[model samples]
Every structure is written in C-alpha cells, then in structure tokens.
Target: MSEVAIIGAGYYGFKPITDEVSFREGTFLAAMRAYEQCNIDPRKDVDSFIACEEDFNVGIAISNEFAVDQLGGVLKPVSTVTSESLIGLASGYMLIKSGLCDIVVVEAHSKASNLVSPEKILEFAMDPVYERFLNFHPNYLASLEARNYMEKRGISNDDLALIIKKNKENGLLNPRASYSITVDLEAVKKSEKIFDPLSEYDIAQYTDAFVVVVLASKEKAEKLSNKPVWIEGLYWCSESSLTPLRGFSTNALELAAQKVYDRTNLNPKYIDFFEIDDRFSYRELMHIEALKVSNKDTIKKDLREGRFSKEGDRIVNASGGYLATGVPLDAGGLARVYEAFLQLRNEAGQMQLKNANRCLIASWRGIPTSTYAVCALSNGA
Candidate 1:
C-alpha cells in the first residue's frame, strides 16, 4: 500500500545557464505550475513545504528562507533540507505516513551559473582537515572511483564510451536534454582526457533547473489527479565521508536499494524501468550494480544487447539522464523521479515508454559524498 502519491510535478530550465530568472523566480514558476495542476493553493491546502538545496550552492544561509514566499508558504510550516532533493522526497513521504501532513510540497533546483567555481563548494563538503587541505580538484574523487571500478569490473574505455554514446543519442529524443547530441562511440573515445580513466565526455556538466512535486495521501491524490504515481517504498543511506573509508563502488546506493526492495517486497526483476544516477558516466553502471539489477559481471552484456535501452528489456534512463540533461545540482534525483512520473502517467511525450507502470530510482549526492536515496514507484495501483 502507498501512503504517498505524487499528484503533480513542475519544472523549468534544463540548460547550462538560466539567466532569465533568479533562483526564487524560477522556483516560483515551477511551483505555480505544480499547484495549478493539482488545483491547490500552497498557502491553504499544503500542510508543509520542503525545499532541498545546499546553502553554499545558493550563496545564502537557510536555503529555504527566500523560497517560502514564492512557494506560498508564508507564515506556514516550511523546512529546508541540505541533502539531495531525493531525500526531500523521502521527507515528504514520512510527513504523510506520520499523519502530520496530508498535502506536502517539495522543491529543488540549481543555479550553477551563479558559481564561478562550483567545485569549490564540493571541497567544503569534503573532510576539511584531510581532503580539503590537499587542494586537489574534487573530481579526483570521481576519477579515482572510476579507475578502481574499471579495474575491478574489467570495464574498458570502449565500455564507458558506449554509455556516453547511448545516453547522448537518447537525449536527441528528449526535449529537456540541453546537452543532448548524437555523438558516435569513436568521437566519445577521442574526447580530451581530463583525468586518467575519466574523459571530458565521461563527466556530466552542470545545468540550471527547478523541480517541484506535490505529494498527498492516497485518497487526496486520487482526487487531485486522474493518475498519481504512488510511492511504494523509499529509503536513504549515507556512507563514511572520509576518502579511505569509501569503497570503489557506491555501497550506500546499494544499501538503500536493498532496503527499499525489502520494504516493497519487490526487486529489479519485478520493475518495469529504472532511472538511477548518472552524474558520472560510470556511476550509472556502478549504481546498476548497487541496485542489484545488474553488475560488473553482467552489465557489459546488458549494454551491448540493448537491455537498458528504450527497446530493451530494462529501459533505463529514458529521460536522457544527466549525461544529456546536464546535472541539475540537488534536483538531479528529483528530475529522474519526475521523468519516471511522467512515463507512469503517460505524459512523457516522445520519450514515453509503452506500458510503463513501475520505476526504480536511485540518486547519489555527486562526488566526495556517499549519501544516497532510492524509491519504488507505481502508476497508482
């Protein structure tokens, strides 16, 4: 049984830069669309409002302070989550399950263009005494992990190139894929190498986007929308932040996946689609393993056999993923969730997958941090 259902979702700007609106304005636009679709006023119907973002990313302390007015949460309960937006989704679910709120709103976005060097903020998230003092590029963490996974999984340059080729090409079918292009495998392999084992094409760039979701109790959701994507299970986990304490793969993502699977009494074999994190090219494959859907031993076959493609058996990352859409900062996970929601509701136009009813989603908190969240969703069964 589902205690929470996503009744509405709204989004804006999947481009490298969104110069038109300030973060607050963009968020307001998205909230307006969401509230309109659900036919609810945030100030009246919403019991609480949650905003997901990091303080440093917004250049403001108490990230949600400036957002309450735009979200219509004036003089009402509003909280800010400094974690990934997917965790905010979990927070909303708990709010409903705990009988605290019937209707909750979640907002997350990114204005990467505002930061002269977003990587600097990532450094702050690292161990200040050890990793931060090294003063090396934060991406070194991704490169190290990629290199280790490559060696351990026997993944070659060609394998990573294939993922780039598939996702970028898939982006061509998605309207929000700002970075989407039809690059060939040879072109991907020829791209400049930024870090050993990780090339320019292998890293997903940042973009601006604000995503808002409206969650309600089961009965309320049915009344709000003809189709509501029910949250079957949701869980989040964190691993050690220290470099040495981390593993070659995202064990936290896997743990969260396992827990969600247990909670729902379901696994990958029973799901229809997936939208795991692909902020880094290899992270997608690594997450696949962690989700227990596929692994290093079997992924190469899955990729080559089109098992993860739109026509494939699994149909993963159908929204073009971060590889094509660019990273949407904290909203990255919610973006995936929203895409899956669209598919489940038959609202995903060209990118829609036929008969798609169930989706498994996982999101990692980008590089240097191991926080992860996974959720199981169905087309309101």
Candidate 2:
C-alpha cells in the first residue's frame, strides 16, 4: 500500500481572539513551525499546497487566493477546500498517493474574531427557503440531535454533564486550550440552557487559530524526520446538507470510520485512543458510538464505569477537544488531527498517553451541516 506520513505539524493560536495576527500571518507562523519540524524549505521541498477555508468565513469570494503568498506558494499550485480541514489533509494524501507530489502541506485557520455577526452568517447555511425561516438559533439543531440520540441510546443528562466535566478538565493539561477549566458536575448541571437539552456549556465556542501539517511520501518522510505520524487510514464523509433527508445517526462518521478501519485492518478496541470532535458535549458521545468504540448497549455503561476517561481504556479528546479549545471553523478537524499528531509523537504534555502508537480523530463542520471528518493515525508502526 502507498504510505504517507505527517512529518510535521504546527499552529499559531488557540484563543477566542487573535487580533494580534491576521489569518495570513497566523498561517505563516504555523506553516513555518511545521516545516521546521521536518527540516523542510517549503519554497523548494513542498510540491503543492492545500488550504481549508470558506468564503463566508473570510468575507471574500476567493479568499485562498490571498493565502498562497504566506505559504510560500506564490507561483506554485494551490487548491482551496471549503470543507473541514481534515478533508484538505485527505486531499493532500490523495495527491501523494496519486504520484502527483512527494511532499505537501495542508492548513486551516479561523479568524472568527473579525466576523461581527457570526450567528447571522451561520444562519445562511440552513436551507434558504426551508429552514432559515424558522427564526431560531442554529444550535437547536445539535440540541435536537443530542436529545434524540440520547433517548435511543439510554444516555442521560448526567452523561452529558460528565462529558463536560471530563473534557474541560482534560483541557487543563493542554496549554492551547484557553477554554479549559476545572468544573464539577454540579456546575455543569447549573449552566444556562441555550437550546433545549443543550446548555451553553454543552457547545464549543469559536477561537482564532491556524493549524498546518506537513505530509510526505514514505521515502522523504524517513529522510526528513526521526518521528513521523503515518496516515494509516483517512477518510471523511458528510451527511446530506439537506437536514430533512438524514436520520442523524452519526452516518458521516460511520461511513468514514468504516473506510478508515478497512484500510488499516483495525477496530476500535485495537486503537490506542481517539481525538474526536467534541464541538458539542454529546457529539463526543455520538461520535464514539459511530466509531464503534463501544456498542450502544454498553456505551452508557462504559461511561458510568469510567472507560472513556483520561485513564480509561478508551481515551478520547486528550487535547480537551473543541470543548476546551473552542471551534476553529474549517480548522476544527485539523485541530483534532493536531492532537492526534501530538499523542502519537508523545508531545501532548500532561495529557500524554503512554505508548500512544495509534489513534482515531474525528471532526464536524458544525451547526447546519452534518458533514464530518474521521481520521486514523499511527506512529509508523
């Protein structure tokens, strides 16, 4: 099989506001760090570049056109992916596997602090004629889904509260998780409800951050770095954008995980851990279910037994996830990938996992879109 490994990864910010750096500068810092890790001179060694961004988020019709200069792609081939960042990572993998490039870079960033009315902009994602007129907040979508999924799976409010407490606390160990906090179940239970069945604490806020990853073919990867995180299995599938046509069954993650697991001949039990999109508290659970980390019959039981905790058999979101880091817009998925890269390389400080040789990472496009990205990474084992 064709082998591609992530040789380097870097980021600039993980904060609610990064007014200090423009997206271009943020991406530059991140890419420079990633390139440095692999001892790469991007202007010479990198073959192509992929930027995960959306026009709406950046307020430009073709924003990535402006991203090239900062990435050392002034005259090189560059592509833009409007999907989640992991999709761009997968695109880079395809480029390598297709014999089109020996080395590639993937990046995603969020400058959400510049957007004045993000809620209004987010509303535009709903079906223009069908759903937008409902005239309520978009997060209600997650609330409804969480309520439905919990009911079917016997998940309760306490489970949601535990998820909040666990992940936010996990954030304490991650320097990048500005949203990280030490909260108990009681504080979570008392949090204000923003949507039915979902409180403000249940959702991840937005942050301005950039994540860049350098991937190379097996030969170059080995030549460039002593520690490489190989892409064992990678795939991303989005459920239909038309919400009415879907069942909200974690279909996106299931489809993507099935493809990834099939590629690596691995299963949930075989994985060392996972770093999934906890854009919402229950989403972490929903994604865990979809990845088959635990069967529905016992997932709730597993939670009660602390099997998904930091020290549990199934370690998830070791970076505090989006719950602690806030959302990074298109960069959200890549952020999850960033966490996976850290654990596999033993760079995830206090949250580090012993012998973290393999992990699964997942991401969602966030409200109004059921699109998701799921990834599996190994320490080139």
Q: Which tens-of-lDDT digit does each residue in 1-381 have in candidate 2?
A: 359999999999998999889888999999999998999998999999999889999988889898898889878889999889989999999999998999999989999898998988888998988788889888888888888988898887788888888888889999889999998778778777768788888888889999999999999999998998999878888778877678576788889999889978999988988888888888888788899998778888888888888789998877888889888888988888888888889888788888799988887788778787778899966
How many pairs collide in each candidate, listed in order?
0, 0
Worst 10 residues of 1 by lDDT: 243-252
lDDT of 2: 0.87
Alpha-carbon shift of residue 359 in model 2 (angstroms): 0.7
Off by over 4 Å in 2: none
| Decoy 2 TM-score against native | 0.97
In terms of lDDT, the poorest run of 10 residues in model 2 is 241-250
| Model 1 steric clash pairs | none
